[model samples]
Target: MAFASYPSLRDKVVFVTGGASGIGATFVSEFHAQGSKVAFVDLSEDEGRALSGKLAGSWFRRCDVTDAFALQSAIRDAAEALGPITVLINNVANDTRHDAASVTPEQWRKALAVNLDPAMVASVAVYPMMKQAGGGSIVNVSSINAIWGPGHMPAYVAAKGAINSLSKGLGREWGPDRIRVNALSPGWVITPRQLELWLTPEAEAEWSKLVALKDRLMPEDIARMAMFLAADDSRMITGQNFIVDAGRL
Candidate 1:
């Protein structure tokens, strides 16, 4: 499907985390297609390098988002490569399911660190850059799992819920600076990992019965929402959770 182009996105510098593959990769590609200068970081060196190589005017850095120092350093390097970041996409996450009863303290901390901390860290790191740019947009990729309160993976759900709250708080704090903060919560996105681990024929059949729309949610669908949030087209939108879940509530 054809997507709309945003004139304001042209020449903007965008930094994306977890952009080596899946939904994050779509974010990088879509933003680049809109004429934005893109810089992305991921733990997968080979995938990151290959993606960057394929996209002109894009840079890739290897960094683990859970490590604050590494994440901050990568943001700095991205800024040096592509001008100050005017758009930030916090898209990295791991949604590995686990029994709540068996979750240890370390596991819980790791879950939050991976799914939530980096968004805050990256936002803080780029705050000055965005302010200096006169204004910017931050799109935090969240999930519908938070709202649904799924039985398993308590930590993952908790992190996403916190992200929703964080987005609202940050939005209020940064509104005066003209920096918009918003959350994009997706539902049942059929990424490579999901296809491999969860999207069995039977599972797909069940998911189809859950949403209002018949079509499955794709990475591109989420990317399009990110593009809208990042562009001037959504200049007044902030502190809100935009759920692209095909009416799954």
Candidate 2:
């Protein structure tokens, strides 16, 4: 007799929002490796399609998470093409840092819609699907700034804080359904773009001072934790925010 396989996301269907780049892209790739049929959404048609082409078990759709109706439609289509979505990763957000006091009201609203509203809509959309699948996981990608109260990103901070609270509340509300909800908050992982455009010597010095790990954190580092959460290894974990900040408080 053949031994049973034990991949955490084996045969599960996962949908990731804003998975075109950064940490979101890593999530998509990691899940695909775990034997899950993964689908992701992004507004960048070229990048999204290219990623889909490269990944064996992945689907990509052009979607703007801020539009609830569009998101709903995209989710439905992804489900139809793939299978019932057992894992939902709400990771889409535009983090264009700006001076809070100078940001226009419209821009603030746009930021919140992209960062916070997508969490609500994505979670809500997957409720029935997860229920049908006999329970599932919803992992929201938040930021360390949620806890740090970072300056100049007032809107982003507010959105991430709301995501944390929403994660807890939803976990409580959906516990009976066997659906787990949680948040993954990452600290200063030096993405390629950040290094080229923003990471100064002063910033590197500060990072070294704060981080407990001598090695620098990268997108893959955060992706590893997400894989744990997506897998059954974290079956008992829910409503808690897992901070993968390289030991940075």
In terms of lDDT, which candidate is strongest?
A: 1
CA RMSD of all predictions:
0.8, 3.3
- Pairs in clash, predicted candidate 2: none
- Tens-digit per-residue lDDT, 142-210, candidate 1: 999989999888999999999999999999999999999999999999899998898899998888889
* Candidate 2: stretches off by over 4 Å: 1-6
Q: Per-residue lDDT for 135-199 in model 2, tens only?
A: 88999999999999978889999999999999999999998888999999988877766787779
Error of 1 at 29 (Å): 0.6
TM for candidate 1 is 0.98
Which candidate number maximizes TM-score?
A: 1
In model 2, how large is the Cα lDDT of residue 23? 78
